[model samples]
Target: MDVPALLDWFDETARDLPWRAAGTTGWGVLVSEVMLQQTPVARVAPIWQEWMARWPKPSDLAAATQGEVLRAWGKLGYPRRALRLHAAASAIADDHGDVVPADVDTLLGLPGVGAYTARAVAAFAYGQRCPVVDTNVRRVVARAVHGAGDAGPPSTTKDMADVAALLPEDAAAAAKASAALMELGAVVCVARGPRCADCPVFDGCAWQRNGRPAYAGPAKAVQKFAGTDRQVRGLLLDVLRDTDEPATKARLDRVWSDAGQRDRCLDSLLVDGLVEQTPDGRFALPGEHGAVSPRG
Candidate 1:
């Protein structure tokens, strides 16, 4: 593999992400990882910047109320990630000496820190050599190494092994290469359409050499948001986020017409610790039953 060529391409084309900048703290990297899960970087950037500016460290976030955390998360899609991140911040401040742990295993112990995220933080944040395989990295490896048109069903063990084997001997170089692989997949080698001409490792790409055959596997399911419980949940949360007063049943009902589905979604949020019932039986963001949170 032309490792230097790949790294050079990355150096030239990589997005100037704040987390990737020099001197970004481990906590900053951790926040970015959690926010970026199943969410696009473009939507995550402003929220991440404001978040880092407000809660510069785990301790800073830990000191914040659950309502404050939820309010700050604001439409990042998966609101549960905000709750998990808050839990992680609490753990870091209380147990880990307010330092984001550098070890992969230790990082995995934190809330919302999965294998890919742990490896990413270890490699990108701490400059350790580790295989950081996400959907993008997995797709890049499938085409570039195995000649497959698409990655197989999520296989962490096999995917990690494939990525680790391709790592350079030098730790820093391996980290750069890992980032490059994900970047290539994200931009040039996109799933639906690959710009092979711009790919840095086009010469060694197995799928390209094999004539870019169509994937014959079963079609992946397309997620629908419109009329789903998630939409109802979002609507309910939106009502709460917009006002200091707890949302009465009639007010919350305005978002969705179906009473059963709306109630189910609200119940789920309450159970998830994202929303709570006020003494007067109105709904509000957790820990913000009557008071408005300061938004920065």
Candidate 2:
């Protein structure tokens, strides 16, 4: 790979994301990584800015109630991630001296910090030369290195090794290269209608050299949002999130028509510790149902 060429392209074309700002801390990078999971960057930016301002450090977030964290998370979808992030904040504050750990292993120990997230924080936040393999990075590697039209099923061991090999020896340069590869996949070597004309490594791209064959790998599952249990859960959570007071079962019923599904979703929410039943049998976000007063 033409590492210098790719880095130059990234230097000129990388998105000016707030998380990439010089002043962003490890906590800021961690929050951005979590928020960016399966969520668009545009939607994450404003929310990330709000979160950074409201909870600049893990301790600040640790001090907040889970209910407050969920409310701040808004409609990011996967409300469970919000809960996990809150848990991580508590761990970081209490166990890690209120600091987002720099090492991948220590980062993985944090709640909800997976392989991709751990490496991302290590490379992007700490400028360590760790492999940060996300979907985009995988795609870029599959095409550029392996000559595959698209990345097949994820193999953590192989994927990490592939990216690790591509990284420059210098830690800072490797970090920049990781970011550059991700940006290239996101913007130029995109899954659909790739703008190969703008690709920095076009001449040397294995997939391009092979005439850009179509992806013939295993079919990927298409996720549906409408009418799924996830949608129902989001609807139920929406009702609780919009209100400061507890919602009656009857009030929650209005969101979904199927009594069984609604009840099941509600039960799941309660089991997940996302919602709590008040002494009066009303549903409220965690920390809002007990002795704690609702935030203004």
Candidate 3:
């Protein structure tokens, strides 16, 4: 697929991401991978920079409390990831002596490090030749190579095989190719509407030739934000994030109109280890300390 041409393009055009700096620490790569999940690069860039500057290594993050990580997470949704990342840092510090694991299997054992993240850390941080397929790369492969309108749900085995087949034998070149493919997907082969003219694969794109047929499968589920438990959780967490002290149950109740949903969301947060309750029956983010409250 003119692999050298693609790699050359990536060498010249790849965005100057901080995580991609020469000899970037493995912990920095791990942070970037987690932050980029389902989040825009524009938003991730600044936050990633701030995070690395604040905690340059896994040991640094491990020393910080979970509350500190959640607070640093800011507007990034899916706060659970922040908690998991903090846990991962702690694990790295305790088990791996604060060094990010170079092996894919070992990285996978870390909290919140999934198949994609594992491969990304191995390839990007250690310069290993591994298939690193995310949503963007999946879409690009689906349309350009398979002639499909969109990628099916992520199944690492199939996706990785397809991407690996396209890689050059040299480890360094393979990593560069992977990045090129991802770049093509992100900027040119976008999901809602692709910029075909600007795409490097336009010449060989099967979906373009087929008139971009619409998928006949069931419609993608639309996530409802209003009145959902997730919305309630967001409201509840927002109050806690803004406050220095733990919030009373009564204070949290005011955020959600439905008592049942609010209680459910709060309970879910507690179950997920994201929030802790004080003895006085106030809730705060995990790691916020207070004396045990006596029974009412």
Candidate 3 positional error at 193, Å:
1.9
Please write out the lDDT profile of model 1 over residues 134-238, one tens digit for every residue: 999988988889888898787888998999999998999998888898899899989887999999999998988888877755677899999999888888898
Relative to the true structure, candidate 1 reaches a TM of 0.95
Question: What is candidate 2's lDDT per residue for 1-296, written digit by digit as tens?
Answer: 88899999999989999999998999999999999998989999999999999999999999999999999999987888999999999999999999999989999998889999999999999999999999999999999988889999999999999999988999999999999989998899889988988899988899978888889899999988898889999999999999999999999999999999998888888888888888787889998668333222
Q: Is candidate 1 or candidate 2 better by TM-score?
A: 2
Winner of 2 and 3 under lDDT:
2
Judging by TM-score against the true structure, name the best candidate.
Answer: 2
TM-score comparison, 1 vs 3, better candidate: 1
Higher-scoring candidate on lDDT, 1 or 3: 1
Ordered from best to worst TM-score, the candidate numbers read 2, 1, 3
Comparing 1 with 2 on lDDT, the higher-scoring candidate is 2
lDDT of 3: 0.86
Q: In candidate 3, what are the lDDT values of residues 139-235, reduced to their tens digit? A: 8888888888998777778999999998999998888888889988887788888888766667778887788887655577788988888888989
Q: How much RMSD separates candidate 3 from the native structure?
A: 2.2
C-alpha-based local distance difference test score of model 1: 0.88
Error of 2 at 82 (Å): 0.8
